[model samples]
Target: MTFEHYLALFIAMFLVAVIPGPAVFAITSASIARGLKQGVNMTVGLLLADYLFILLAISGLAVVAEVLGSAFVIIKYLCAAYLIWMGISLLRAKPGTSITEPKMQSTQSAVLSGFLLTLSNPKAIVFYVALFPTFVAIENMTYPDILGIMACATLAFGSVNLAYVYLGSQARKLLTTPRRLTLLNRCAGSVLAASGVTVAVR
Candidate 1:
């Protein structure tokens, strides 16, 4: 890829990374319950999953992508329902009653949950497949150039996502009040559900 192509890819990926999704929700929920360190760890897991998906996208797995795309509507609805359930549960949580009171989730669970949450979204896979082709010049670019573009895109994605974790961690302070916490949960839930519906309809 040319420098201009890489820059464009970075900008596009950065914008997409900023949008809230299941991965963002997972990080925020983890931050609220477990603390910033755990939230960052969850972000790491998410990044790993994203890299895996990108690899699949680049490997010309168009058949798999098509199959996944065909089922994306159902997957999106399921994701929406799960987010709504989690949000309602959060809304109902008693104030000052710590979600981390019980034993913390194992590292494996955190990583696996993050990975599954990211990878299960077939739309994301298709998006990467479609997106990379626009900026990646297969004829003119060397392998190293392509790798560099991927690296930059990955770094941009991770950095933007970590910022979300930081934001969500700070939200713990504002969530001190039960009402405010409830409202936060509802709002996040609504956003997630709406995004899902939009995905399905699109």
Candidate 2:
């Protein structure tokens, strides 16, 4: 992958992490409820989920790209539409009221909760699969490209999770407040929308 593609992938992945989706909610709530240690443990679960899903998406789509020839390009537009729709939904949604109290009691449960939450979220698969082609030509994907993609995902997602944990540990109220959450949601929405437009235009 070129530097531009790598950078785009990094930004897209980072925004996804920052946007406070299911995974973020799960981790942040744990951080708020239990402590930073629990949150970090939960992050391990999410890391596992992301690794599994990224591998699945890249490998499965590589086959589709190989078989569909130029027809695979259609998937790009569909993904663009999906992203824009999500952006609009976030923008329209009401501000978050509070972080739900997480009830995981053990280390195993904490990790399992996060892993299951992320793994069960179909959106994770769809977004990763769809977003790949936005910066990569799956037909031309190599082992190194796959490795780089996985690394970008790990760095971006892991960093965001850690930041959330640290911030939530210090002042859980700061990020979970209605007003602050609203601003964050809108900012995330704008990033998502712009990303979609970029993908579509390309």
- The lDDT of each candidate is 0.64, 0.66
Task: Compose the digit string of candidate 1's lDDT tens values, residues 66-88.
Answer: 76764555555555555444445
| Shift of residue 147 alpha carbon in model 2, Å | 1.9
Model 2 earns a TM-score of: 0.60
lDDT of 2: 0.66
Candidate 2 regions with alpha-carbon error over 4 angstroms? 61-104, 172-202
TM, every model: 0.71, 0.60
Q: In model 1, what lDDT does residue 115 have? A: 60
Q: For this target, which candidate reaches the highest lDDT against the unseen true structure?
A: 2
Instruction: Give the lDDT of residue 176 in candidate 2.
Output: 59
RMSD of each: 3.9, 10.0
Residue 69 of model 2, lDDT score: 43
Q: Which 10 consecutive positions of candidate 1 have the poorest summed lDDT?
A: 96-105
